[model samples]
Target: MKAVETAPHEYMANYVYSNSGLGAWFGAARLVDATGSKRGSFRLNGETWRVTLSYQESGLAPPEGGETPDGTRVDFDTLREFRLNAVVDDEIGERKVKALIQPRWYGLESESGKSVARPMWELGDAVNVRVNASNVEFDTVETAIQRAAGAVTLDPMYFDDRNEEYSVVMDAARYVRLDRDVSGPVHAREGPIARMGHLLESDRSGYRKIVQDDTERVGYYHTVTLGPKRVRECFPDHRIPKEFKHYYARNAESLPDDHPLAHPKVEASYQGSRWDETLRPVDHDELADELEEAVLATINEAGLPTQPLDDDGLGGGRTYVEDAYFEAKTVDRSRVLPLNLERVESDQRNVVVRQLANGLSPVEWDSLKTLVADGGDVSPAEIADEHDWHPDSVRRGLRRIEDMVVREQGSVALRSHYVAEQVVEALDAAREGVRNAMGTAANAVQNAERRSLDERTDELIAFCQSNGIHIDEREAQLRVRMGNLTGESWSELVTRLKRFWTAAGRDPERLKESVTHYRDEAGPKIRQARGAWTGGQTLQ
Candidate 1:
């Protein structure tokens, strides 16, 4: 029988080809300076960077018994995997490195389930294949390593660019801001995500520090890592055939009749992305859904990068993966939202409180109250145990109020001291039967004010038009609002606008929306001053 390979790629592509935009991820093993010695330097992208060496000895024995025809011993008792990691910092930047890279070898197959030892010559061939498949200069990196380390065989190391984490380096220049509807542009802070600090009894290893380092400004990329063992424990209802583990282990043999992949429909789905197969045929959807759930559950799980790093944001380089989608020619850059850290303002906090009061169920309110009263750092399990509620129920309640909370080290807390105060105030008001009334009244007042502004803006536009001056509505509103905010006399503001149109080489007789665009392009400080048009009722 011909050796058959499993079509995991087809299933895997479903994840990569989904509707979601590619987020940055650090997918490589955390840089462990295992050897604690820096190798010689090399240049990359026209910058000099130092390389470090590390070797991890895998306890798992190498494939045994198979040997070359010449009778050299094939199996080794232990396998030592070497690693080379490199980093170069941004210019004059305090810490966050501009590029963190692990050299990759091209000519080697994945070391997934090889049952036999590879020939000794393949390592040299692999090195010759190039690091990152770049030009001759990069290839010299191998020669430099050979000269420094002396007779080291390069293992087939592969780095997937799509797995890199995006750390938005904070500096004086690229400060983040949010353009507001009412107040103006406000500065923001990026906080890291909380992660489980300890190991799970069932897991082998973990990356706790990396998970906790992920922040709103930093994208934490994750891929599906759940395999057969954990999947069976969590999702016993699904039809994950017992033979699934060994499916990839065997290269060419046809799957057993009882295996899910052995089914005709499952095989057909493998041929293309359009999986026409029904769920009942192989329970694929059920398995996929359960696997996805398990993946999410692993966010702070042990054996993954879920621990908080204690390095004070200075030491170490992160794994970076640039997504394959970014390389495509047809990407719509316009639709991409700028990824920036944003500060939640008092108004925003008020809005969230109002939304929560109006939207939360009684149980959600209870959860919020409990969180506030518990010193704001309790675990979800403790909250569930406190109320004797099912964990899912507790989670559902908390999810409804998640906007006002920040999670850290496997515990939850109100987002800030302000949020805590707001929660307490809201809770007190609720007891008095007026919790929602204040929020509602406030919203109503704001709406009325906006409506009044709209009416005045229309009157101002008409007033200007009658005076033989032409302007777009937005432009007119901005100018009037600018005048009001600045306390500029109405006449001086009008003269400035007329001059703006004249300077732009546009006649007042031919009004264009371009004036509004011009006003927006005037930059943040100018735009901030123009949100609400107010002042003299009569054209001055």
Candidate 2:
């Protein structure tokens, strides 16, 4: 299969979703020590896990029709006592943390000469709307009882949003974070295509709101920080801080389209495009195997694609034949992105030229200008000789120039494909004959007259037992290393050989004959089985 290309970055859920927080899962946790009135911020991965509980005092029971996605039976009374687990920390900047719910569409390519818009969505409607929440809290003053051993990760981000789609509270509570620790079980619906962040706590005390400023303070949206790539504040918090949203408040009138990121792109025409599609150059040894004498010899008539070559004509031709060649198209890797590199290098060179001017070094400029003219390939030694500068210093400048040039010239691979499969088969008979000869040499214990086999066997036993060994265990070890050796009674032969060595030796000549007998008996059978592995090649 051709390699799968990565989806665009916008489709990726960067690690740090908002407020430098690794988003948490809802309705997914277990208190290590469950006890009534035992409540505190359940720390997840050394970070605080926030739990939100709100209830109407007069409510005696949960409202009818209130059901968790998992069908977890609950009512208004149940919601009164809620527990949400969310990572909490100091989130500062122009806006509060929450998901920016913008309806997005992919594959909106233009055909003919017209344009089209894709679907849109409101954040948190289907998704957990967990809308970034404040860090976890404890109703009762107490420290976290159990230190979460591993990560407190959610089933993929969109999992909850997919669940409880048909439920009514989804719309009413479109922007509420779940108190999942107390939520119990929740089911996920797979049909919807949407995503949202939990509503995190606001700087203002008491009730918190979602951040949704599109224009002003958009830059304040959280950046994603994951892994070593330094994922920091990645997702845009839907909640907008009052002061920061002021910049774009007036501009919000022409939203969705007027949002800087939603600009219309005029795609260039693709008159006629061809790309390099070859996987890689083929191998040589694979082309060396012969097959006609092995499989075709059994054919008395034509095969499926056509009549098979007759047995009489099987072994007459050259070992192998391959005549077909392919036509491939490729991009000019050098020039396709030339301007990208040039612009980057120009910025760096301009800086170097300024440095030369600041020092008022006429000689330096002459040497540097000449080296620059040589492009990125110019050598450091050449620059040093031309500028009368030290080699080490010139080397550093050359490295900087090379880096600037490469950064300027972005590198991208040309994708391409080619098609073809050839017939390949090996003669197994030949392989077995070789194995038989090796086995015979190994069985000739009496041939070694100078040192007794029992002497060596004793030494082997001593070596293994010296390090704590049992007889059965040592025999099992020897059997494992036998790998792919051929013999109808190979296992029996090994047992007998070990036994004979433990006592007296056996005849060397008879051992040789046993080897010959094995090859003659199994060689042809092994050869016939080769096609069983590759499946007989059907010439079509």
Question: Candidate 2, residue 292: CA error in Å?
Answer: 57
Candidate 2 TM-score versus the reference: 0.16
Report the lDDT of model 1 for residue 288: 34
RMSD in angstroms between candidate 2 and the native structure over all alpha carbons: 33.0
- lDDT per residue for candidate 1 within 1-540, as digits (tens), equals 111111111121100101111111111122232334335444545655444555454333332253323333324344334444433334422211112222112122234643222343222111111122111121133343333232122221221112212111111010000011110101111111111111101122211121221222222221122223322333344323111110111221254533422211101111111122222212343433332233222321212221112235331232111111111111111121111111122233433434442456766676777787886478778877777777788777776665566555667766554456556666665676654443532333233311012233333333433333333222233222331223443345555565554443334443221222212222322232222243313222
In angstroms, give how far residue 486 of model 2 lies from its true place. 78
Give each prediction's root-mean-square deviation over alpha carbons. 23.6, 33.0
Model 1 residue 67 distance off true place after TM-score fit, in angstroms: 5.1
TM-score of each: 0.26, 0.16
Give a tens-digit lDDT track for model 2, residues 1-540. 111011000000111112111122222222211222122234444445443222222122322354432343333232222122223333322111122111111211122322222243222212222222111121111122112112222223322222222111100000111111211111111100000011112111222222333343332222110111100111121111110010122443355632332221100111011111111102111111101111111110111111112234442222111111100111121111111211222222223222321231333334345433453334556667767888677545434333112211222110000000000000122124423322222222223222112344434333322322222111112211222334324344334444543442323323222211113233321221112233433121
Q: Backbone clash tally for model 2?
A: 64
The residue ranges of model 1 lying beyond 4 angstroms of the native Cα positions read 1-339, 343-354, 357-362, 375-434, 437-540
